[model samples]
Target chain A: MAKMTLDQLRKLREEKKGDMVRREVEGKEIQIIVGMGTCGIAAGAKEAFDAIVQTVDENGIASSVVIRQTGCMGLCHVEPTVEVVMPGMPATIYGRVDAEVARQIVRRHVVEKNLVENHIYDRPAVDIVKK
Target chain B: MHFSVSDFLLDLVQNSIEAGARTVTVRVVEDRGLIEASVGDDGKGMDEAVKAKAMDPFWTDGEKHARRRVGLGIPFLVHALRQAGGDWELESAPGSGTLWRFSFPADGVDTPPLGDMAGLALSAMAFDGDYELVMERRAPARGTEWTVRRSELRDAVGELTDAGSLTLARAFLESQEEPLDGIE
Candidate 1:
């Protein structure tokens, strides 16, 4: 297929920029990252990723949430891991996440601010040093 | 070792982008008892020596990631395709580009499902870079064919990165692949 002209591309980019800005200004503040490394993919991270995206979109919360994919987090055993980072909160990592678990993570942890106990995998442990 | 063909394709596209490709095209054609998938990229193509070594699972450029010591994308594909009685080819020149094509028996038990084509394509577009992606699928068994271009999509939906635009792109790609879902 022939490529689109530069003018056309620029026009589209401009038109979309306005929409993006408006959405960003109104949306909530949350970021969700899904592990999509080879191990993660083999363990069904793709489905979890899609499920999270679909749930967010269907709930009309796309503006508030930013979803992304990342390489392995050196936790191959816990394949299909998802990390959720919210404002003023420590990053939470959930492993062995499937489609259903992903939806719950979005609805509960992301929306309701309640960590789903069963699915929570990792929380940074504070270290104290006394001299 | 990907679970689905879409995942595999996504990996291939990632490889292309990592190779500095500005334009990537993927074509999947299912016909005559075979499924053929081809990915072409206008990237910094490898020389003959590198091309020959690309299939080695232990070989890598060792420059992209400081900790990464191996490249398994092409090697994995080669193993999977070979195990399923399939074949693959790679053509590249130092300054030109690269084209990698592989085909396997459509009815082979080891052949993976195509997975979510739309999701894969859209995800590729979501990469943080200035590039264009085109995906085409021709399923003779289902007597259907369709093509999606990122440039055209940008024209239709303003920007692909926008949430609304992404939703539209996903829906459009899904619609195109819906009819062919049951064929295989």
Candidate 2:
């Protein structure tokens, strides 16, 4: 019933190789992490996650940014959280990120090089785990 | 509590990921009136005693979340299934893996509507790790079925985290699921 099949995917792959100039995800500059744990999903992280993806895709910055889904960040009170790590910019964690907030996050914090200060939940140490 | 079955699937699959599963399989069979779903993972599983303990609402071992003080996933799942006139099956053991199966009346008063399948697939694929997810959906009444394999997707699209690929992936999943699913 679907239009995009295995063949379509392969075709897209080939076409993308020719047309799309994508950067390697391994050493990306910006990394966006969305909490996908039970609590987060219950609070509608699924929609937020999709919205972030859609926004980033629309903005055409899929090359430099890598979107990731993480389990939990220990912020149960504010489920559906989004953490942005731009490597050089100060990392930020926004709480209660709905679809709209998720889009704003990608547009403001990630694309425009600013932070969503009001919704800031917590700023992690960037390295909670010892290397 | 999980508002929709999609969230339930995500929660349990995340459990599998946390348990160290290298491969995970998810199946959903939906007819006009019934919805049956299952998720099996090759992750470290719980024994009989541990499984029983995990079902307790007051139990907390940081198994699912570091800040999750109470056991809400399984307990609420059982509670929701019962309220929806559904039953469940779970198979697991120490050193083995875990499999969860359940079905509910789609028209039940307590049943939640389907969530966005495209989002579910994209979210699962977005996890940062080396794991494979095989998602299968079937609608016998409509005689339609579709399956997405992680390895195949990876081969087609280098990394799912890329926004361009994710967009394409979401479009593909939505197209496949549009005819088979209900309200989100």
Candidate 3:
């Protein structure tokens, strides 16, 4: 459990910095944001979030996929919601997501570019405010 | 209610941050079939009455968030640890800091898995605020003890939540985990 040497840490930092630069230049970055507010945590969003991260890592897609944790999205009923944003694509919000669904999202929605129809929760916006 | 050890830890760390802690320290140690964890924070500590209520799943201070009616973080951890033949204690005094210490049988059949600590550490950094987080992992069997500080990480990179910084932090945190053979 001894800490890594300063040289090792420096090298790792440099590697990560290089990776970030490479990903940015590729312009194919995907961001996966997981709601982790109190409601989300009570509903087990942590597991789903971790599952997605592990899936992305296991598939060696870390260079292209970025996972982030965020506060509530005002959808308490859909506690463990995950929002995915891909380059040149509309952001997709998935509801009632579990660990298994998280994996599916990465595989189908992210990799294959096919939205998982059943999990999509966002609806078309309506103009309700008076002009 | 359902969470891995890492999840539990992240929740607890968030709790400390919400308590207005300027500094938080988390330590996990495995020794002789026992796994011990402690989180200490220099936050707005609780008195006896508040401490008692904090242990109740149905009780919440109502100051943090108005929408939520219950605080299950402490209670849930207590439940899991006790179910696994472990015990926990909390020490706090108003105007002082708080410390939570818990231990469980490492090999217990009901003990939850350690899960992903790297993710936990990264998430802790995502928390809103400028508080410091110190994490240490010790495995006597392997004669290894690794320690890290949030400030040091920030100094190394720019921000922990940045993509590149997060990647580096995750790698560093994961590297501290004890080998499978060292857990027992």
Best by DockQ: 2
User: Which TM-score does chain B of candidate 1 obtain?
Assistant: 0.91
Model 2 lDDT tens row, B100-147: 999989888888776766677767767889999999988766655789
Ranking of all predicted structures according to DockQ, beginning with the best and ending with the worst: 2, 3, 1
Index of the highest-TM-score prediction: 2
lDDT of 3 by residue, B7-104 (tens): 67777777788789999998888898888888899999999999899889888886644444566778888889889999888999987899988887
Arranged by TM-score with the best first, the candidates are 2, 1, 3
Candidate 2 Cα outliers beyond 4 Å, as residue runs? A17-19, A22-28, A123-131, B63-68, B180-184
TM-score of every candidate's chain A:
0.72, 0.83, 0.75
Query: CAPRI band of model 1?
Result: incorrect
Q: Interface RMSD value for candidate 1, one decimal? A: 7.9
Residue B97's lDDT within candidate 3 is 90
For model 1, how does the per-residue alpha-carbon lDDT over B37-65 read when each residue is reduced to its tens digit?
99999999999899988889777775544
> Can you tell me which runs of candidate 1 are displaced by over 4 Å?
A1-26, A116-131, B158-164, B180-184
- TM-score of chain A for candidate 3? 0.75
